[model samples]
Target: MKYLFNLPDFPDSSFVMQITFWTGKQILFKNDALVEQSGEKGKPFLIPDGNGKVVKAYPKPSLPDFAPILIINGEKHRIVAKLPWYQLVLALLPLLLLYGGALGGGAGAIAAMLNMQVFRNEDSAAVKYFKVIGITVAAFAVYFLLVTAIYSVIA
Candidate 1:
């Protein structure tokens, strides 16, 4: 999924920012042309402005708040518009189920993948629900498999 945001307006400038979900690729465009891009996620990268002056850009995490931030030149900007309530539920759903224990860690990893996709806007409501449910089931399967393996080893 991709999230797009309009950069703060500048004189004779038509800068639009594009961010790809999961991979966290950020691209800056001016006048509908690609100017700069970076694949750094949760890290800073430099891009040249319309004036040919370099500015810093960083991609922040996409969880808990569901508000992914893209900081440019010491200013904060949201890459995605509109935070859906379902995203919040998906982000916190794993926490409610997987808390503490070895099995929890394995399940939590699966949940993390789900959390990543949950933020993507491309999926329909029904599709998103199925993803959440499927991931939850996969987590349980991992937990059970781990338990069975551990039990057999102990026996």
Candidate 2:
């Protein structure tokens, strides 16, 4: 997906970055023009801005806080869409609840993926929160069903 970032010294909405979630490939663009591209996931790309200045961009794929950052003249710029606090808490509920043990961890992983996708989207606040709640309920229901089936089999 393409993420747009506003650099400190640059014009409004000048930086554009694309990061492949699964592959980790990162592409950087300035004002709709391709500046630098990298095939390796999570690898940093250096782009020469202007007047012999260089900008270092990093594609970070860490869970719950997956945001790419650009280092322009020693300052860091985040390239991520912001979500509301309530929505953020709701999205993280599943991962917080079912985070331990093998079966629970599986459910947590699924929920985390869903939450991550929800946060990554550029949708409206209401839609994002709805997705978070919907995904959380769905993950819990699936976890319950799996546990029931396993218990029934053992008994």
Candidate 3:
């Protein structure tokens, strides 16, 4: 059976991240948190009320915080700084282009939002901008299709 999840704020989003089964029941996980519970499975291993799935199902593997980065672009450019995810992305912006060129960060931003929920948020400025760009592109595609159809009919 199909199930639906409802979240506030991002009201238009369900964002069913990952689904995993335990024993026979189905659990819906989102943002590393189990948001929905279903099925009939008696307690076997853990707590009596624990439908088998814990709050943290798949724990993020601990990653070694240290790793040397070697960059070769005629001159050796070594990035020896430790930074967080956002910081790393920002820091690596300039280095995104390997061959010395404009690394189209705008395109990168749009492409990265390939995920439906984040990309479709009308409230987000980035999402709105991307939607405008997408609509413009779609308009062109439709126009071309119509023109082609008309040409075919005329010819």
Candidate 4:
């Protein structure tokens, strides 16, 4: 996803904008430039402007905390753009429902298939399949344990 925002009071001069993801991935954007570069985790990088001033880039504390600070000539600017937590939860709801549906054997399988379709476009094939299988297995394991407990109680 592309994050777009304006930094009020920022100098009009061209400068580099850097973003470090929670997964240790980095992306760099040049002012009025379209090229992107990867960044290193836990390492500080310089965003130099043509006027000889440099801005420093740092990663946020954890996932969902999209605030990254930019230090321009010793002044700190915290970028406050972030994806809402509800939106993220909504995206993952299908996977959670798929697991819940797994409590029923054949019915669960159908539900899982339907739920998997929701994420078909969001992730790559490998990732999508991996998550689907993983959740299904985990749900089946939980269901088995529940059944075993009930059987023991009845006997």
TM-scores for all predictions: 0.64, 0.70, 0.23, 0.38
What local lDDT score does residue 75 receive in model 4, on the 0 to 100 scale? 58
Predicted structure with the largest lDDT when compared to the true one: 2
**TM-score, cand. 3:** 0.23
Q: Model 2 off-target regions past 4 Å? A: 23-25, 33-42, 59-64, 119-122, 153-155
lDDT of each: 0.63, 0.68, 0.34, 0.48
Worst 10 residues of 4 by lDDT: 111-120
Pairwise lDDT winner, candidates 3 and 4:
4
Pairs of residues clashing in candidate 2: 24-41
List RMSD in Å for every model shown.
4.7, 3.7, 19.6, 10.6
What is the C-alpha lDDT profile of model 2 across 1-155, one tens digit per residue?
A: 66767776665538777767656567778888787645456456666666687556665543455555665456666777555676566767787545546777678666866786787677997887788778888878888788889999999
The residue-by-residue lDDT of candidate 4 on 1-155, one tens digit each, is 12344444445634344444324355545575643332555455555556777555553433333335554445555554443454344333434434444444543443344333433336875776566566656556666677678779999
Candidate 1 vs candidate 2, TM-score winner? 2
Candidate number with greatest TM-score: 2
- Put the candidates in TM-score order, highest first: 2, 1, 4, 3
Q: Rank the candidates by lDDT, best first.
A: 2, 1, 4, 3
- lDDT tens digits, residue span 1-155, model 3: 12233333234434232312122233443434555432334211111123553322221212221122221122222222244575334323322222322233333323332222222333676655555456435434544566578779999
The TM-score obtained by model 4 is 0.38
lDDT of 4: 0.48
